[model samples]
Target: MDKFIDLHVHSTASDGTCTPAELVKLAHKTGLLAIALTDHDSVDGIEEALMAADRFQLELIPGTEFSTEYHGKEIHVVGLYIDYKNKALTDQLRQFRDFRDHRNEKMVLRLQEEGFSITYNDLLKTFPDCVLTRAHIARYLSDTKQVSSISEVFDKYIGDGCRCYVDRPKVTPMDAVSLIHQAGGTAFLAHPCLYKMNRRELTAMLDELAGAGLDGIEAVYSCNQGSDEKDFKALAEHYHMIISGGSDFHGTNKPYIKLGTGKGNLKIPYRILENIKTYHQKEK
Candidate 1:
């Protein structure tokens, strides 16, 4: 495999199996040049990742993956090269965590009422330090014979319109992009193809996001097919946006996905790192 950097990864601070420091070590062993611990909606892992980066002499980019809403569908925006210590970002994450806790409680109740009999306690035990997500619940169900696998759990129980599916409050896409920019970060759409939008719809969304101050898009993703990658690359160029890529690593929750890299199906341009270096050089 060609040497590369992974821009999207997670740690136990959110939903990944590895800790932040462990993730950095894994990146080093895997021969990655640089990596970003873009945990979901939190920067708690950044400090630890930073420590590991220093020890291993690896370049670490502080980042986060935020969840937002657009047209009633979930939109994930990735903020790279961020100031993890920014107070406003931390405060907003606090609010998001609070909401997530409540949402998890509701989901547990719904699952119990639907004859699953799984308690919130069981989920918490499985994810003591990490945020409780539907993914965690799915894992629990799969482990206990309630479901065959994580994907099956989502498909039959907790997925959209499934027995335990519930809507939670989400930040608006515009607001999310603005927050990242305000924190001195570049905001990009993560896995735009996963939204399953058609060409016209994708174009419309890209336009709207550009207007909202989005700076880039994930042109290379782990699960993106060859045609999808081409389309996203073209889209990024058409919008004059930065092209980024990542494996969307989640440790055990997604054992198939690895740390600090995507699957063998991507070609992340090295220019993305050069662009970021240039931007920071100019700022300095």
Candidate 2:
């Protein structure tokens, strides 16, 4: 009954449970008008997702979530409607994968040092043919009885400031925006409220990013509170940035919120898609 567009979802190519094709089918069944596979640091799902889109008549946006550093914090930049075949984009993502692999290895070593016996090979077995992520590591911990739940893994080891946390290489926000632009996409700030910054800090960060050619912001997201969503929508309007929203689905890796749930309160206006369409047309 609801016509929606879920712009920030993952598949097996990243940390989600479904394959690209299966996820597309699910979206069609759920009445999503369009869907973007904004997998973290990878566009591996784009090709299959596009094919599935053709089958289901769903609009597909090639997307990836890149990690960027700003003011000592990690922020995510989601590039939408990208040319996945762009050599520059592919090359940069490959480099990011390499960095991620290195970080995963370091995380395993850190966990080992903390007396957890998980190995990289053991972790790889969990998601063959998919990008490895912290979610995968957390799942491994939970599955093997190393931890009781994924949240435990995060609280004890993988979360920010945890004992086994390892920093990965990140691009500056400016460079990330530039890369997304070069790849023929618009860079949007993903899940701004997750940064947990106060009003002054969040506004300052948004202003800084908007000045750096950031084209949009996630005005609605799963984790945002009512006030937070209203504030972000106002910010988007004031700054003339396109509004973006998503379910932030990660399969069973997240238990409470399912795909397209949007924390049960978020609704993205169809006008956002019209805005994106208009912007693309003008670029042509």
Candidate 3:
């Protein structure tokens, strides 16, 4: 009877299909002791999630997943135990949302050029309040039968290097770590293995990020293989960084990943959250 937690998750506040309240209910039903609503580039859902947490009698951690770039590659930094009301954090994320709106317009235009007959207005009508993302575009394509599947939309049009792809404005990894700290949170590299870098390169990047106040690395992730876990653990130990993990669940948006358990075999012990809290206390 070990308590489990999901440190990374998204709701309709971002690209995820679940609303904050629904996500909280699902976490309780799934028997997770706690869950962090780390929506991409936004904390808009945190307040709603917090209310749901109280109603459901579950622990909720206020967090965000900040998008960043390093050497032109997209990197994600997870900010745990953040002050969601922090003005600096909100302002910065608002700037990013503005950039995202502009980028979405460009993407829609690119798709229209390809004779897709879709418009940004159409996406707005479908997802009125949710943040627009490539996933939304993919969903639009899939729903209209323009693509056979969501994966096809990515593979054929909107994925990185695809014809309709457009890069959003992002901060440097150092700046991202700094922003997390500014919001009174610890920054952890999200899913390092997903970067697909060689061991040496990855080590160097982690070393640099550690120097920039990166507090942890996601050593136990839903998609991680046994070898990946071992490697990430070693890296965390070597860098004297805290270890973290999560399911990265997105509900129906990513149907394969589950809430606390990922792929039906993943189990993240509660000790990880305890360790993170311990580190936060020590930092204070």
Candidate 3: residue 77 lDDT (0-100): 93
The sequence of per-residue lDDT tens digits that candidate 1 reaches over residues 109-160 is 9888878869988888877878777778888888899867899978876798
The ten-residue window of minimal lDDT in model 1 covers 260-269
Model 1 C-alpha lDDT versus the unseen true structure:
0.84
TM-score per prediction, in order, is 0.94, 0.95, 0.98
Q: Per-residue CA lDDT of candidate 2, range 126-231, in tens?
A: 6898889898998888888977899999988999888889988889877888888898898899998889888899889878888888888887788987688789
> Of the candidates numbered 2 and 3, which has the greater lDDT value?
3
- Is 1 or 2 the stronger prediction by TM-score? 2
Give the candidates in order of TM-score, highest first: 3, 2, 1
lDDT by residue (163-189, candidate 3, tens digit) is 989988799888989988999998999
Give the C-alpha miss distance for residue 275 in model 1, angstroms: 1.6
- C-alpha positional error of residue 20 in candidate 1 after TM-score superposition, expressed in Å: 1.0
lDDT of each: 0.84, 0.86, 0.91
**Model 2, residue pairs in steric clash:** none
